[model samples]
Target chain A: MLEGLLVDLVPYGKAFQDLDHRWMNSEASFWSSGGERHFMSEAMVAARHAQWAEERERTGGGSGVGFGVQTKDGKPLGYFGINWLAPAHRLAMLGAKIGEPEYWGGGYGTDALLLLLDYTFDWLDVRKAWLMTTSMNARVMRQMEKVGFRLEVRQRQSALADGVWYDWLAYGLLRDEWAGRATLVEQLGLRERAAALGSGAK
Target chain B: MIEGTLVDLVPFEDDFATYLETWMNEEAWFRAHLWERREPHTEHDVKKFIERMEKDERGALIGFQAKSGDPIGALIFDHEWPRVRKAEARFFAGDSRYEGCDEVLDALLMLVRYCFETRNLHRLDAVALPFDEAKLDHLRRAGFVHEGTLRRHIRWDGDYVDMEMFGLLESEWPGYAAKVAELGLQPSGLEPKPKPEKKDEKKDGTG
Candidate 1:
């Protein structure tokens, strides 16, 4: 498990799987799916999990890796991970979501992202990490910029949400450009939580 | 077959599989045309790929035949998501002689027409490696706008290279078509009709 100031990245077990339908069908879906509407049944979520397991087994866990996000006290919040990893290029695409609305803007997502980035750059040794989001996802745009990710591409009118078109934005961060988890915690004002979590936090 | 002034977009046939065998083995061409890592493909592998492409409903693989009846290259339209009315376009000239030539431009224009007009797709996306200037120029000339660059997107010979992304929307086609007509690059059959002298006479009489 990867530790963070306010949350821990742990195996996405059955508990998280049970929550998939609710999270995927809620407003949280828009953030993760780039504004595409999704209606995932429990059975569909199970099938998706089976597919992910088969893929992970076939690729020996190299193609993609994901984890559930939970508070240090064991309360589930959301999940995030490397959506795709290309070892040949040492690059990976990262995705995350704070499924619980109450946790929104509380820095839980940021701490989870920092943990994922730490795992990606330090553990996986990826040279670059990137992601794609729509311009309508203001939270993600601010989160990406705050984490020092550069806005690399903006495909105009590429996505539609609520009958309006939005630009598809791609953000990239190099391994060398990452400020490390500790620095980010301090920069993002999560240091108070880090202190409460004790010495090895952040 | 979609016929153009300089080339015809023909359907893929067993004969085209041989070109794939050769092109897939050409390291430089393969690197420039595709994003995946390079691996040697046998004749059987190439045949399997052709059969799959033939049966695939998601997209199309079209061959380019020059006016002289020689297979010069191929145009690929794949990654099609019909629900969203979008697809990706890629092409390569197996015959080096036709690379960056006017015939290639003719082929591209035909592709654009087919995608936006015939297929009625909403958008077409394209990508080019950093070293592929001819393709970059061709995409721009064919009405695709440079959307953004994916930094260190592909690995090339122990180094990483950027890939430039381009997009063309259906609404933008008329402007590009006008530009093509203004530049006299449209095929003879598709060219804008010349103004009639009778119309000029009628206007003069009205005045």
Candidate 2:
């Protein structure tokens, strides 16, 4: 269902060094927020490892982006992931930890979520996708909504960061949306699906 | 809180007859519907009236038993305002044993909420008679506003009487539901909120 260049997954613990500079930029806390203070040390890292591993053990999820995100020239910018989801539900929650604050507002989130959602719904056959973000992170929420997620619900006093609870916003999107594919199809001089559907309409 | 185990309108025929008798005599507008201008001759007539409600083109029962549980009130969907998705309501405790009671008012409020929030209808309206002073007071207490009066709206006895209109909007249903739920007397079968997810996407994806 999707035609594009495939992403190269960086090997586990292979010192994806180019990606390391971005990682030390510590996008995890930049996105997860509160730096190392909120969730501390190797214990926190072990917990992260266990949480994802247990989920994978239960649901058989693939390693998100195989380790890290890399640009065409091999410059690593962010790490992306897809939470395994069932076909009928059709949506896999997605997130990216981009280390570079310089790259924060520069379309990195949109491009990565598009690429992840593109893979989840098309290659993975996801029909609907949902994700959550906090009201504190209005920037990320806007990036999510720009990619076609509409607010479905909001939970109050749910985010317990820095010993305080913040309101969390949840959003959802459907597969029929993905303007990039239509733009690409147009760019590549392909027949519009409307032409194919014309006969069905009759 | 007018609640008891719900009984179908058939066995509760006396309740229906009592409801009809008071309605016919008390409101000049209802007198015209009774062929005898008195009570139904038998339980068969009350059953026939309820059965006739099923044949109504609206395609669903008009009222439900709530608060007092013997079908004392209703939240009929799509009774009028075809384009807007609206309903009309009228209710009474009916039995001479229960006149002047406010239990049916609680029942009507429950029914109004079921029609608006649960059924997703935009509007609800009630038509009352100008001389029907106390019922109009009940409607206002239930959060409905008098929209206007319809002069010569229904022929009563030998003459038409002015009819009063009351209306409510769906936007007002939630606060009303909150107020009603506080009474611990709910319209049967209304769910509270979103069901608990088997696994709530945990905060920080660490559920």
Candidate 3:
């Protein structure tokens, strides 16, 4: 399991299926509003996990790494992952969700992002990370901006949601920016870790 | 083979793998354009590559000189989204001799037509390094509009580089037909002529 201040990143398996199913059937739609929402089944989630396992093997440990975000008491709250990874280039794409509506607006999502970004830049050795979200996702946009992601571009009228067209916004953050977020990096002790990694420290 | 003006896209064969390896690793502009390390590939690696291409739904075609049948490059339609009917097109002119020629455009035209007409795709898109001005201009002439730059999207030569994205919808193809005609971008031997040549020339009536 991956450690974090507010949550732990646990492996995905059959045990988490119930909460994952509920998440997908309900709260997940608001996040991926551009796509047609449908009922998700355990079989589909199992197949996706199997695919991720194959991808990890294919990329030789350089591809997607998925995890279930859990609380200190071992309650699964949501999911997070890094995909489309190019280890040689030190780049990857990131995505995450805190599916439980009661958990929304709490610090869990932000903590998950911090931990994931730290893992991406530090452990994965990825130098840059990026993601795309719909223009209507103001909550996610504001949170990402706080973590130093810049609004790079807006793909106009790229998505159709509820019979309306919306733009897709692309955001990116460099390792330097993450390291320079100052308070968060210091609070997470990532600054010292980064310095040590630079000087070949563990 | 998918025929074009100067080139034909032949189905990729196992024997062509080594040649492709050379082009990807030894070609002049390979490093500048491809955002990856130039690692040497063994025969086993080549075999794995061929197997993956054979199994992948994404189309991979080898560009060959229509007249001489010599391999020139590779054209790929990757990241296909069947639900959205969109795909990303990528090409590398391994044979540098055709860099500035219209052969690349001809090959692209053939591929674009196949995607829209044969494959029934709604959109075709591509990404280019910001430094690739010639390719950007070529895409523009082919009616692809600039979408936006992905800031620091790729790492090339130990530095971060931005990628400029371009897209073309099937609805826009007709407007680009005129440009294609003006450039005579067609199969090599099919260029339209103003008139047939006279068999005998009258040299000021002195012949």
Candidate 4:
């Protein structure tokens, strides 16, 4: 059994899970809308959205924060969310799924992961974050690093990918150890976010 | 819109909602790339990604914005892989009055200034699918060097798709900028070239 390479840690929404059910299996990826193996169905996407809603209430999180992804034309694509978030722990698990494989490796999976990391530490005051990936997902390992996750542990032959056991890679990061947060803030034009803070402020 | 002019790896987290917006941006990027590859990502997956990013700062993201008053399609200097200190110069009509994506590489020169000269970065690089002949040609026109291909690097449609990487060194950028400047807006349009003037029809018989 190998660790998962999913970009988000939260259970997927109906749309997202649909993506997961499709891409999680290598064979189903062929019927993807983008001619890529990474597309999901509607029923699968909603389930994850439910979890996201639950987590928001438990954490005083906002519903709009529930993340959504789509192409420029506004086509629903995949979904992501923060799971197992511990305010005191300053830690949260991130996860995402793209049913349309055409968009796989297109930078969204990794970029979306970084987006959440940006939110938790700066405004949310979290200290750090971590994630897990299967040894079979070398591409995912690279993607994890691209978003700045460092390997924390490697469970030897802990999981299976193709009837063979592979090591699972667990990666994490601290706020101070992070790079590009300030630039992203500036990039996002949110310097005045100070005025936007507070649960009821919005 | 505080467009991306300067960029660096950001460790600080973004607001939960803002992070969601960033995820939307990623979705757009993925779609653009998918169009090149002839596909798309999960439709709503990108927005979910933004929310997740709001939870932590494991992977620092870059910021991009266009300068105010700079033509919407004129000056688009954005960082792609800032670790490589590179930014993108986009020029798209987007189903509007505009027609093509020709000025993409040419617009990059101004951004190269912002990166190398203003930001004090060293080198810049860009990637293009070999199938995206238009984009690839623009890079070549902008004086970008064809570095090499990773070959079947990206998994697409149950298999891997070949990807080509191109690079433009800081040292090479200055001369290229000069070449483009000398031409002024003479080569403004990205449309395919018209037939050359024939020798018999030459106005000054210089041919």
> Which candidate number would show the highest DockQ if scored against the true structure?
1
Candidate 4: lDDT of B161?
51
Per-residue error for A185 in candidate 3, Å, reads 9.1
**Chain A TM-score, each candidate:** 0.93, 0.65, 0.81, 0.62
Point to the candidate with the largest TM-score: 1
Residues A40-123 of candidate 3: C-alpha lDDT, one tens digit per residue: 797886676677668778867645777789866677888887856777767888877777778776566776787788788878
- TM-score: which is higher, 1 or 4? 1
- How do the residues A1-202 of candidate 2 rate in per-residue lDDT, one tens digit apiece? 1122322234334345333443644645634542223334555555665676687677565434334554434455556666444332233666556665675664445545655676676677766666667777878887766666676545443344555546556666656655554454344332333243231110
By DockQ, the better pick of 2 and 3 is 3
Q: Number of backbone collisions per candidate, in order?
A: 0, 10, 3, 84
What digit string (tens of lDDT, one per residue) describes model 1 on residues A80-158?
Answer: 9998888778889988877899988877889899989999998988999999989998888999999999998888777
Which prediction has more favorable DockQ, 3 or 4? 3
Per-residue CA lDDT of model 1 for B1-207, tens digit only, reads 877767788987744655767775774357445567677888787788778878889888888777656766778888887756788887887766666776777777788888888888888888888788788878888888999899887788878888899998888887435645754653222232232233235655752
DockQ for the candidates, in order: 0.46, 0.01, 0.34, 0.02
TM-score of the second chain for every model = 0.83, 0.60, 0.78, 0.50
TM, every model: 0.89, 0.40, 0.77, 0.35
Docking class of 2: incorrect
Rate residue B46 of model 3 by lDDT: 61
